[model samples]
Target: MSNDILRLNIPPEEPNLDPNTVCKTYPELSQEQYSLCFEHPDVTASAIQGIQVAIHECQHQLKEYRWNCSSLEKKNKNPHASPLLERGYKETAFAYAISAAGVTHQVAKACSLGKLKSCGCDMSLHGKIRQKWEWGGCSHNVEFGEDFSKKFLDSKERKARDIHGRINIHNNRAGRLAVIKNVNRQCKCHGMSGSCELRTCWKATPEFREVGKRLRRKYEKARKVDILNKATARYRRIRKQTRRTELVYYERSPNYCDPNPLVDSPGTSGRLCNKTSDGVDNCETLCCGRGYNTLRVRRTERCDCKFHWCCYVVCQTCHYNEWVTVCK
Candidate 1:
């Protein structure tokens, strides 16, 4: 998290050399570095913005390294779940790398006096390159749960190969001088060069360094805790819950019977009827021998019965005019 600027010796390249030829020799230049050369430096602005961007990107790389290391260590304790942990590391690393590059580009543009321009590379070039590195090439071939240290070492090798090519191109005398002048101007603009007498800006403050360090530590701790807690919670939920297979049976009351069954009998033609020794009279009565009572009793008996397919059942009251049989 140190804000101390590390001075890189970026001497001018040979003036007679071709930029394309030099670029061809080194394929390792990350998108961030290439962008610096192509955008701000190619224009009138100081390339120091690019260097600062590189520093920011380096910090991101360092943070990613720490995160990955922590993940690997955590996974080691759970050897059975190492593959998933490794995948997490790779996915996080790829996303972080891409995001860091983009942020660096944005910060460079914001800090610089000039605007961002296309590096003459195709609009899709950055995306394509990132895909190749992250999905198709070495990054993809790396196995999860294997030797993470060796995988990191291989990554470093690939990065070194890429950087060597880019630096060689920037080594050209004219390009180097241009970059140096641009950087010097940028430094002076920020009052970090010549008679300005300021050693560094607020960006290089100790408070900022401490903040960055504390934030990174907190993020790492939170991430680890979250991973562990989520996994445990999921496992506990799965273990505590049981799977069911039987259909839920609901016992429903029959709709045939009523407390006042004879009140509205169809046999009465919407009127209360009473048959007694006195005479036929319009009166309500509870008689079991009534025609409406017989119908109600029969319906209730039918409703109380239960039938199932693929079973043996012979209806004792099979006196219905129309009957159907089904076999399972």
Candidate 2:
């Protein structure tokens, strides 16, 4: 199995015990990540949640597209299915960024919510903003989250020092920056009669959905980079010139319309497609002009729900026929 901690071969339900046992529990983690877990002690649980959040958001953002982030799907049949992650496609770049962002976001939120003992609400606020409003609310300590994410997520890549490693590092940083850039100022009023007399504001991370949208936009405008080893002078020059927030990738993706087991791409065949809409999910775009098969099927659902005078609710079983289109 790959050493990637984010892979679908998740560790089984962890028994609640102690922080010092993290290394022993998650043996799949790289040596560097294990060491970081050992040092922080309290951040490992949150980091695991971060990965799950990243995967969920990725699936949500790409649900309408052809690729649909299916390579990351967890299946009992294919525990080692991660060829897409092995490539340097723009999709891979997105995965890296979103995953890192997930870690940074989750960790920061954990700190603010008192879930992590090592950290708490960000205390770095200063300057003209403090002059206007009191920083009393819990601000997500994103800076600390970003730093910790870099130390742990980027650890495996640091050991490689190859072109792939550089690309991963760049995209990972872009993910962290996405979280930082989207931090919003949230405030609450303390006046009795809902008056604007006093306001206390604190920095808050944007909803993860918003972060997913931001990263999706970056994926659409991803920069195609020339592949090169870290030792090359051209590689250094490109690294210096590239913008920090831009997503960069070296390899072109193989248009995920057809299943390619080689890359773990479970193509669009047999996928449901909308026949009438002109969106990316429509049959014309999703099926890649192979045409789709329409089947009339009856669906049974609970409808006509009514609330009784007391508290209980009742619903009637309804049957309806609909035309379902599937990619050929």
Candidate 3:
């Protein structure tokens, strides 16, 4: 594989990957897995979309948090260097969840887009099959997506029996489950004389943002698990006691406010913060007892609008000053 292939393996990279030659792009993946990625042309597209969706959704989900998921770029570039991987932090859970969800969302969409030759829109609905209603819309083929994601993403942890390995597998599956659970039926009513006699419904996939939101909720409620004899049944029992939908971790996250290059902490210095709110964006709490600086910012906007003539309207430009806060 070439540098392009290596660069395209993870998210935040340009999504200009060629669909036909994706498998050859990732030399890190096992030969068997590499071949599997190209087993069908649709897999290529889905795989690319998966990486993009994971990073984009994760960044959006953590936009307000102190760390803001920016550590993902480094983690993706060097998986072993990631602090999240070494410790079961909330950030680690988010990473696993977003990556799995991305693959799940893309595979389902690719199936509906006619990219997958083996499966099209879902036709297993009882109403459509029984002729109670017409299947006039494309359904998200979540079944295929879930299966494919399991086979592909889980393969990464196949040889590992460590606690981190097990946690990764669990989190990844949780992400996939979030996507499958969010699939809903979207229907349209149709009948002669506008009567409510028949309907056509299709399984629709939720926006990737919804999946991210669900995972974020899981991250908040993530459980700390103990690795007791990871090779024995006791470990399985302990892990099984936790809810499968909840993200499982082994350690608490570090205080990300301080600069710690060893763990990829960028620190909150110079970070923009909101002075008007008490949320995560609040300057005081985000700066971790470190003082902040307030600056007067000038801004312009279209302030006044007036109707003109028959079809047009115009607005007047206005200037305003606002106070902005930043971590010092």
Best by lDDT: 2
Ranking of models by lDDT: 2, 3, 1
lDDT on C-alpha atoms for all candidate structures: 0.24, 0.76, 0.69
- Prediction 2 TM-score vs. true: 0.81
lDDT of 2 by residue, 130-224 (tens): 54467667899998899889987888888877788888899999999999998999988878897857778888999888999999999999998
Please write out the lDDT profile of model 1 over residues 33-92, one tens digit for every residue: 444334333221222222233234334433313122222122113111223212222223
User: Candidate 2: how large is its RMSD?
Assistant: 7.5
Candidate 1 local distance difference test against the native:
0.24
List runs of model 3 lying over 4 Å from the truth.
1-20, 26-32, 73-83, 126-136, 193-196, 228-234, 296-323
lDDT tens digits, residues 164-217, model 3? 667788888899889988888677777888674888878888987788999999
After superposition, the stretches of candidate 1 with alpha carbons farther than 4 Å from their true spots are 1-26, 29-87, 90-111, 115-211, 222-328
